[model samples]
Target: MTTPDKPLIMLVGMGDLSARVLTLLLGHDATSRVVLAGRDAETARRRGNLALFTAANLGRHADIRSVGLDLRNVAATAETLARVRPDIIFMGASLQSWRVITQLPKPVFDELDEAQLGPWLPMHLTLNHLLMRAVRDSGTGARVVNAAFPDAVGPVLDKVGLAPTVGIGNVANIVPALTHGAAHLLGAPVEEVELRLVAQHYFSHYVPRFGDAGEGAYHLDVRVAGAPAAVDHHRLFAQLDNRLKRLGGIDGQLLTASSAVRVLHGMAADSGVRAHTPAPGGLPGGYPVRIRRDGAELDLPEGLTVERAVRINEDCQRADGIERIDDDATVHFTERESAVMNRLLGYDCTSVKLGDCPHWADELARKYGEFAARFDT
Candidate 1:
């Protein structure tokens, strides 16, 4: 429950990302109250207790609560939201984890990887759409930080005035890499370097793997000692590709969870924090943002207007396997992604209407499960 002195922070999913976020919150002693709500109450309680125990042993403690929540049931979720009246909600639920695709054989994984992250829109979109509606209906007015594929999901929800406050990870993950690389090239300390990056999910995923943006577009500005610096983008990325070594698979969630904690603290603080976030205010991609208690606003470069920044991300959508998202919330998949889904899973979804996301999500999950079963033996 919320109190006048301490704010209630709600974690809506019990997934790995949410667990990591919970642990970080406890370790940082960022919140006094936290509620872990998910589909399984027992699992949420277990995780919450373990987190509290770990934090207690480490000399940090919090009032942790857990409850079963079926986000698919909007009325129930809304009731819980109203009851808890949390100040900040971190939602990370999805029909299926993105890692599920990577579990396939290497050849099959590479084949699906060609489609990028767009073809699996339904799996990521439905729960968020439902949660937003529940948020609106509950009228809690809590700041929401979504951890799903916010690049596309955020914009689609924006069409209906249901976008979350801002998205975490994605572009944020790139900013740290760029900041460290720039500091190394400038022979400055990392703390003295400030980076403003505007990129989408595709570029974020691509640059780490291949060191370059491939065909995706982005805007990057670097400053050292509070003065603008002229660093070569090519050399910066080269350094990242050569020097930065990251753990693969679920191990990487630490970076993402850390990013989420940063955004959460920024939003909870009275003053604004200069940060990078994906899908702020339902934009096409990520941007340099100023996060405060009020909300997130674009803190773009001097020459970049919001319109131009959006256009850059809009053009790069195809790189993420999305052709476009219509004003009415209809999502058009790129030809490559559509063809790959059709051929591999026998699920022919070229476009998806926002209202039909749940059905599409179910169908896609079923087909993908059957397809993955073939390789089990």
Candidate 2:
């Protein structure tokens, strides 16, 4: 039984991950409903960890339900939408995309029609298309959150005119992590160190992997008291940034899952406080998200840096390839992503291009699909 007045969140993936998110959401309030969705509801239900999220948390009125949904099929997705009429929709389907894109022969050079990497782009686009339709039909202003790479997906979704209300993870998660580290390096409270960062998807995704992200190459500035001061983190983060840069061959599922959990915490607490988050509605950029208590709609704060970050986020994400970060000499994206895209989508690298992508768009999508198809658990 629902609390009647409780907020309803419809989740696309009902695994331990989604269960974790639901558990976090419940911590904030008992008057909440969570509808776990997937192709195999029974499997999701039997996954004791996830099922226990609702069974133990809500007592009698704890609203947790399982439903069958094949998001790849637009109509089926729309059908799920019609039935739930939820207050919020969190799309983690792209997590599967991440898994898929990671598995290909990396930069697949040869492009074949069936083996094309770009075909998978349609998977995301179509799912979003159907979801948007469902939102429109449901007549609910349910905020939509994309739980995947924002830089690429955000822009792609924006282009298709179905950008989500916002994107989770990406640079948003990095901000806090870096901020925390900065505070320690500066020998100040965790809240004292502030990051006025202008970055793209690669900065967030590959920063830790490369172990030496941007370094002097990655542009960043730290402030101690509103204005810029010579903080030790300025140099320390640079070193750590490089150390944390994305590594070519490394397991990232755990990292990705941790980031997902952070996203859940930030979004679930939106009703209670002001916090940081990546831009919503797939704005193709970064922005300070002030989640409106009334409907959880995020907005930019008043300031030059915040505005500029938002602008930079959009520009880098929208460019033809490797967009200039606010006219600074810093590289916003790399050919690596493009090559990955091309191999993933099986598309001609030349035909597919993004401002920051190192390879073709279609190729990446196909690779993304192939990577996702093989996940056993």
In model 1, residue pairs whose N, Cα or C atoms come closer than 3 Å (at least 3 residues apart or on different chains), thus clashing, are none
Stretches off by above 4 angstroms in model 1 are 1-5
- TM-score between model 2 and native: 0.69
**Each prediction's whole-model lDDT (CA):** 0.88, 0.52
lDDT string for model 1 (1-377, tens) is 45544568899899999999999887654464789999999999999999999988988878999988999999999999988888989998999988888889999998878878998989999999999999999989987899999999999999999999889998998788889999989999999999989889999888887777888988888989889999998888876578975765699899999988888877665348888899987888899988887568889988889998999898888889999999899999999878988998898999999999999999999999999999996
Worst 10 residues of 1 by lDDT: 1-10
Tens-digit lDDT string for candidate 2 (118-186): 223334444554566566655566667766554445556555455677666556656766776677666
Model 2 vs truth, CA RMSD: 7.0
**What is the lDDT for 87 in model 2?**
63
Using alpha carbons, what is the TM-score of model 1? 0.97
